[model samples]
Structures are given as structure tokens and as C-alpha cells.
Target: MRLIAFGESFVAGVGDPDHLGWVGRALAGRRAVTLYNLGVRGATSTKLASLWRREAEARLSDEEPCRIVFSFGVNDTWHAAGEARVTPAQSLLNARAMLTEAASLCPVLLVGPPPIPDAGRQARIEALNENFKLLCARLQVPFIDVFRPLAADGLWVCEAAAWDGAHPGAAGYQRMADLIAAHPLWRAFTLAE
Candidate 1:
């Protein structure tokens, strides 16, 4: 199996001391699979939607089994200079475009963005997560909600707070990975045929 994990820093495993962000930790021991981690530190949904297909296609072949895992939106909700980098409505559009096209190619999963410490930003992240979930359901795509659980999680909150007020450390990443790995859709998507 070939898996392409694309998105922002969380997907890249930024603050984890072990350097095996959720993707590396979650998919560990699956030797039959090769993972391409295409996480950019500050990518937004607009950038990801425009780029994932080209990047994923370069590393894939039609005859091979492959999958795409997209985890974004935290960056989209990022506000600087008195405005969000990308608005919530635009973020949903970007996600829909990516998921719709990716699913047409192969099985795919959408991992909702995790929460950060800022209350204002966290609120936007939560709303975006919910919107993404609804969009996924409408499209019949598999979506995993990481925001609410991690926001309420002590480890994830503290770790993210201490690190960069955004990304978490190893333990937090492990918990996030555990959550995803435990999801039934994730299991079915990754299981060997």
C-alpha cells in the first residue's frame, strides 16, 4: 500500500520530539506500505487543493494500490494582521475539491485539523471541523474529527501550549494517532486485501 499524507505542520510532525508526527506513529510497522508525507509548515486549504493532486500523482501509478490522507484547516483559521488567512467558507470549498477528486482516484480519508490553544482560533477550528464533517458526510467521504477531543484533552492542550501554542509533542501526537488508528474507516482503508 502507498499512502500520501498531505497538509500543514501537524501532518509534518512539527513539534514532536520523536519526529514521527501522527502519520509516522500511526502507520508504523506497516512495512508493506510506503508513506509520502507532504506536509508543509504553513500551507492553507487553497494551497493544498491546488497542489495535492500533482504531488500525489508524481509518486503513484495506476496499477498500484494507494490512498491519500488530508489533514488541514488549522492554518486556514490562522489570523494575523486582523484577518484570517483563509475564511471558513473558502476552507470548506478547498476541502471538498480535494476530497472529491482524490476519492475518484482511490480510497481517501480526511482528518480534521487538531486544536491549538488560542480561544478565538480554537473556536474557528472547531467550527471548521464540524463543517468539514458535514461536507464529508454529504460526499460520502471518511472524516475524522480531532478538534473537539484534543481540545478537551489535557495532554494535547498542555503539550501544544508549551511547545508553540499550536503543535504538540510526542505524547499528544501519539494520542491523536491512537484516535485515528482506532477509527473503523481508518482500519478498513489501511487493512490489506
Candidate 2:
């Protein structure tokens, strides 16, 4: 299996103490699968989507099947301080575009962003995430709601699992990976391989 992941710093494993990103953590023991981490720190969904082709070309071959995992939403909500920032509608559009592009290549697993504490910001993030989920369903692609599970457990806000109350620590990443690995989509891929 050739898996390519694209997202922001969280997907880049910014706060992981072990220094191995989720790709490294997730594909650790697979014998025949090749995992590629295309996560870029501070990459918005729009930017990541734009860069996807360039990055994917280096790892993807014409004959090999591929799977794309997209993680975003937090940056879209958190970085909207100026007029140029993406609105909720535009955020959804960006996600849709990403899904559209990914579908053309292979199966896509859309992983929604983890929850952030600020209620005001979270409202936008939640809207974006919900839209992403709906879009995934519409596209018949797999969707992973990391926000619901992580937020429900209060792991995202816990101090021990984060450095600045946002990004996940190693334990948090482990928990996140566990959640991801257990998802039916991930299990299906793992088992199929």
C-alpha cells in the first residue's frame, strides 16, 4: 500500500515527543506497505490542496494504487484574523476541492481536525468539520471525526496532552493514532493489505 497524508502541523506531528509523525507511528510494522508523510506545518487546507500534486508526484507511481488522508480545519478557523482568511463557506469549498482531487487519484480518508478550546472559534471549526463530514458522505469517501472522539474524552484540552493547549503531545498523538487506527476505514486498509 502506498499511502500519502496531507495536512497541517498536527498532521505533521508537531508536538509528538518521539519525533515520529503519525505516518511513522501509524505504518510502523506493516511489512509491504510504504507510507509517505506529506504533512507540512502551518499548511491550510487550501494551500495543502494546491501543493498536493507536486508532493504526491514524488511518492506516487503511475501503476501503484494510492490512498490519501487529509487532515485540516483547525488552521482555517484559528488563522482567520484578516479579510483574506477563509470564511466558513470557503473552508468547506476548500475541503470539497481536496476531496474531489483525491477521489480522482484514489480512496480518500478525510480526517477532521481535533477540537480547540475556544468556544467562539470552535463554532466555526465545528461547522467546517460537519460540512467536511457531509461532503465525504456525499462523495462516498471515508471520513474520520477526530473532533468528536477527542473532544468527548477531553483529551485535546488536557494540559498533559498538549504544550500550548492546542497541539497534542506524544500521549495525545498516541491516543489520536489509536482512535484513527481503530476506525473502520483504517482497519479495512490495514487488513486488506
TM-score, each model? 0.97, 0.89
* Candidate 2 residue lDDT tens string, 40-130: 8877777886898778768877776677788987877865445425667878888888888778877778888887777776777778889
- Candidate 2, RMSD to the unseen true structure: 2.1
Scanning candidate 1 in windows of ten residues, the lowest lDDT window is: 184-193
In Å, residue 87's CA in model 1 sits off its true spot by 0.8
Q: Rate the local accuracy (lDDT) of all candidates.
A: 0.91, 0.77
The alpha-carbon lDDT assigned to residue 89 of candidate 2 equals 80
Best by lDDT: 1
lDDT of 1 by residue, 55-144 (tens): 988988786789999999999998899899999989988999999999988898999999888899888989999999999999999999
